[model samples]
Target chain A: MAYELQYYPGATSVAENRRKHMSGKVEKLRDISDEDLTLVLGHRAPGSDYPSTHPPLAEMGEPECSMRELVEPTPGAKAGDRIRYVQFADSMYNAPATPYFRSYNAAICFRGVDPGTLSGRQVVEARERDMEEVAKFQIETEMTCPALAGLRGATVHGHSLRLPEDGVMFDMLDRCRKEGDVIIMHKDQVGRPIDKKVNLGKPMSEEEAAKRTTIYRVDNVSFRDDPEVIEWVHRVFDQRTKYGFKPE
Target chain B: MVNSSDTNSSDTSFLQLEVSPSRLLKPETAQALLNEIVELEGIIRLFVHGPGLPQTVPYGPAKGEPVHHPANTLIEVGGQTMELAVYVGGIRLEVADADVKEQVREVCERVLPVPFEFREGHFIPTRQTVTDYAKRGPGADPVMIGMTDPKGKLKDHPVCILKSESKGND
Candidate 1:
């Protein structure tokens, strides 16, 4: 008999959010057009054919490998598309998604992805078309809040900094700005100006963000508040410390 | 533009007005808050603090591109026009005494509708440090002590001197 897979061990909403995110069952909050997402990504121009690194897998004539036959290639891998990346910086101020959570979500949900998580930013790299689909899904889903999360290819500052008066995360490049109720991205992720502004839907309210956040903050649902999470964390810490050193 | 002569005033008490971390102050709001506080008695020095908004992209692929941040603009504060290089999140004030601190707190209460932290402590340096000595030299202006980075250019960190019940603009 197969055992049930529990993503996280906690009774708090923060843990629940983490589990939901890791399970890839998050709600879709907005519908950003593919064209707008592509423009902001800046990896390729809108409606342009994806530049390929090599011939399609079907045409390349692969060797007789059991592993290659067993594993199905992603659409991008099949097409031999160039590798591209999409990076996100989520604010520390009760953002819906955190860097580690974003990486975990990508690893669990996406196929053939290279997800990297830092203290403040998360980057996921895949073939061009696959990366686009991943970026669009993450941007349109509840995991992202326009004001608190930013698409930054470089100079990903302001994740831990205070929000500006406009209630938007500070970007040194000034890629996105708050326009009344919604946030608009006029510059691409790398700070290059796009032809037209992309309208990221309205940001979530502060109260809603707090409720949906996966972070464990003292003011909110802290780590200490969840005993099960604490126990699991201690077990992991103990295992890593005790068995990390093995004589060669 | 603060000079050593202006440091003669005996405003020893220090207080910091920190706005809520969730939001920074807009230029207009910062101006209003500064204007209100400058008019109050006992304030000798005021320093605005927050993350900087660089004029140009400091690094990365688009390094020379203009930032053009809305917060990085000129604002009129205490009858003087100066550039606000950062998003205003906190203000450090050197006042005369406890009574003046109260008055300043009252002014801040009136000016800022959002929740703020009014802290009375040594938030500003009372004397120049070694960095100041190395950068500004022996005859460094006492009034401008500890307010800026020693290695940075003086023009980048302009100090506005607003005398109580006076018309001079420094």
Candidate 2:
């Protein structure tokens, strides 16, 4: 069967996390809106006392970030930002079928991002940092096997991406897709982390697409596969990708 | 090749000329070689000489047992280090601490010719172990010691090794 690969960096990042509220892990929530997501910037854990992977609900020794935040990268997130984490899911390593947060098994929630200017400019800077990391991971994965070989040159059909593989890694990548999940993805910005403000309350569903004032502009979300590679991939992707999205 | 008898001196010495690389090595080169030998000897004595590395599994059946071993690179031939030698066994290299020794032991058992009986005492140590035991209280197991002349025999120099100590403990 032909593989239907979806490479949505933002959504895929929170594969194991979209259900934070369902698990009863977050507490003392303030301004938990789409805008908050952009302000938060990077991955964060929830509880300070929870574990290394989670952000502290209150000020604790460990980084207080959410599991979802950790799954994505917020390279520009500063120390003073209030963060909370519950669990962390990392699919970059090990098998793809098992979608858990990460090794810490904790999640994070955050408020009061960096206290610095939480503007679109700040968010873009933060998002760029995260994307570079994911791009680097894509490179490393390509080196390990060929399935991800031509990622930088592949075509993006909506959110879908087609990368060249050496059978083994492609088999794994094929198994990457899950059931009942609508994955929107793009490898062009695969590892690149983005600060997005996709309003959950927005009329994104067909039921609300008509007469819906809430416009959902799908911003690209990047993964911080490696801290160092996040920026490197941005430069490389610009040179590698065939798309004509030049600097406006 | 000249025999040991050629070393004979005085009292009607017979001159049987035999070619040796010594002719080309020269005294300065020889001195440099000698200096290298001394430096290597110092390294071995300090690290590889004794039990090479003292492995004591506290509360294990052979708790105080010392294991002597040499790196495969330093072949023990007639109690001398040999540059060239075929090793029959593997060197189960590993990092060990309180928590990870069991894992290290499993690796060692597979590589070393010794059997894998932790409490039953199944480990053939190197000559280095003999000296290590002499330093620690008294007689350690014999297998811990290595061969005498490993070049032709098992030189069994000590197992020269050390590890970075962890946090807290001095």
Candidate 3:
């Protein structure tokens, strides 16, 4: 199975929103549901309750989960609600997942908080901070640590990973984090980071979402050495392929 | 632009921030919050208990100080392991001069408290108040902190570092 790490607002909504004024330019958008491995990040449906002066545009939503409640004005919090989640993007997690297990794909997630305003540059910077903050939460303590929980991909740059100059990349990100940059992923655009943008104006039923494409809600993650974890990724990949929409 | 790998030191420290709940800040009142913080700089001494924490923050009372409001936390001071950003601590700085507060408030997000005089700023600890109700945990400093460097100069309250022995082991 192929998996890619993505950033927020990168995921456009499968459901059309009236308030957003979207013109169907975005295609292959995935559903941010519990069932699908992919998720919708900062990009939200019209009428989403999130506050405007939100910390950083990148932080509104994305692969980060612990922050879901504090920042994201997600619809009612329930078991059925889709979370700010992501997908594996590629076969990186396939057999012999350990080597790949040491790292995660770095992605740049962004969103226009105002929707009416905010230049692309501002959105990019916000993502930088969000990524940094995520790193802090990871190394600082396990209480709200992303590492302690199911690992989530952060937006750190991964330019020279071992496979592609990997050692230097990981070191660089760790260095950035120490300097307080909060480098999460070791590289940039290593793999696909699933993105889901929701436009609230026009909502889609669960059936509509399920019918659109293949999704595998990441139920779990663990040490690649742990055979069960590796086996599970394979199972989820199978399920994703079973229900996932393959590109034509 | 220092990288983490360059550092040979293992000692790491984090900053602790406390927004006076007494202000009764609301998510909507971004401007008031910024104003209150700036104003507090003048009467900063009046607010601190040990006279150390409050003294660490810098007071910019110039009638015509250049406006300083960053949309994101920019690094104010950076060294091997030490860093100080006016907004690095996740506290948002609000200035009434440029209408920065108003623009930030339009969003539903909480505005972070901003800082000034970072490297030269005071050494603010993690916790401020102590109660008989709360349990003291490991890694917490226990002392009636004051503003004095090891040399006994009343140089600055917050920045003055006292040895662990000086603080007295409880």
Candidate 4:
């Protein structure tokens, strides 16, 4: 008999969103060009070659190990691409992905990934090309809300602050802003002004955001409303506590 | 600190109106509200507070560059010019009596499109602090003790006194 896999426990919409993101089942809503993605990332130029940290694996060679023979090297690894990162600052006001969920999505869905979650922001680091692919998935899927999340490498305040009068997330760097109804990135993640304005589609309406958000808030779908999730949390805690007390 | 006996005998209370859809208030909305409230009797002072807008991109790769925000501009209020730095988070009204407070509430309800939570409390310091002396010098007016800007030069007055014909009517 084969065992089936489960992502998360809950009956609410938020929990469902969590399951979808973790399983990589989310629908891609927009297609930002490779050039535009690279522009906002600001790691390297749009058409520039990825800088290498070391000689390619084909040239440097490898040690004789069974594990190394079985596992295939990723394209970035084969090319000896330098490790780079993309970070997101998600708003506390029902942003599509919170810090923990972002890390979970990255860890479960991608290969050669290193994800770190902080209080207000989440970071995913990988070899340059791999990182760009992951960043595109995050930006295009239901994982990101253009108005509620920002691509920020530094000075990432305003996650907990109220949204500005324009209904866009507060960004001190002003890396992205609304042009009419469309949200455009006129600056890179680090606040360096860019020559071209990358158009990120129109922001989600408040109603749509609430429906798609993975966060459980009392104002939206409360966590307490999901009995299965609560029970699972308690069960996990109880097992950890009991196991810590004595090992059989 | 201003001596408790320094201020006039009028009972002063702060009426704080916290607006919803809290971010992104238009300057026109603020202007309309101010024009209405400033004409009401028994109102001693008006102050607007919210997130501060820095003149430059204070940090990161674009440090020292000008920050262009639509909300950060000069607004015309009651025929007086007022510079708005932050998105108007809330408006604080210092009223002399219950009658004036009621009038202010009515004005807010009529002017503001979004719902607001009305609170009565001491939102600002009534007395002077050591920082005031350091910033405003020794000859600072007692009435303006707590009103001076902390970042402004010693010679700069925090609050501008607008001379309008409506001032005498109030």
Best by lDDT: 1
Candidate 2 per-residue lDDT over residues A1-248, each given as its tens digit: 99854321222323323232223232221123322332222233222221233333334454556874566434323222323211111112121111121111112222222212211101111122233232222122211111111221111111111111111112111112111322111111212222442221111222322111111123212345333344555766976774766687
Question: Which digits, one per residue and each the tens of the lDDT, describe model 4 over residues A1-248?
Answer: 89877999999999999998888899888889999999999989999999999999999979998998999988889899999999999998899999998899999988898999999999999999999988999999989988899999877887998777677988766778899999999988877778799999989999999999999999999999999999999999999998899755
lDDT for each residue of candidate 3 in A1-248, tens digit (9 for 90 to 100)? 78742221212221112101122122322222321211222223324433333344344445657776466542222212322222111111111111111121111112311111111101112232233332222222211111111121332222212111110112111211111222232211212222332111222222443223112223222234345445666887999988887778
Tell me the deviation in Å of residue B85 in model 2: 29
Q: Candidate 1 i-RMS (Å)?
A: 1.5
Evaluated with DockQ, which candidate comes out highest?
Answer: 1
**lDDT measured at residue A174 in model 3 versus the true structure, 0 to 100:** 23
lDDT of 1 by residue, B56-157 (tens): 888877888888888899988767788998888888867766787788778877887577777766666656665666677766656667677556788777
lDDT string, candidate 1, A95-138, tens digits: 99998889888899989899998999999999988888888888
TM-score of each: 0.91, 0.16, 0.18, 0.88
Off by over 4 Å in 4: A241-248, B1-21, B137-139, B145-158, B163-170
Candidate 1, residue B158: lDDT: 65
Per-model lDDT: 0.83, 0.24, 0.24, 0.80
1 or 2, which is superior by DockQ?
1
Sorted on TM-score, best first, the list reads 1, 4, 3, 2
Candidate 4, after superposition: displacement of residue A193 in Å? 1.7
Best by TM-score: 1
Assess the local accuracy of residue A248 in candidate 4 as a C-alpha lDDT between 0 and 100: 58
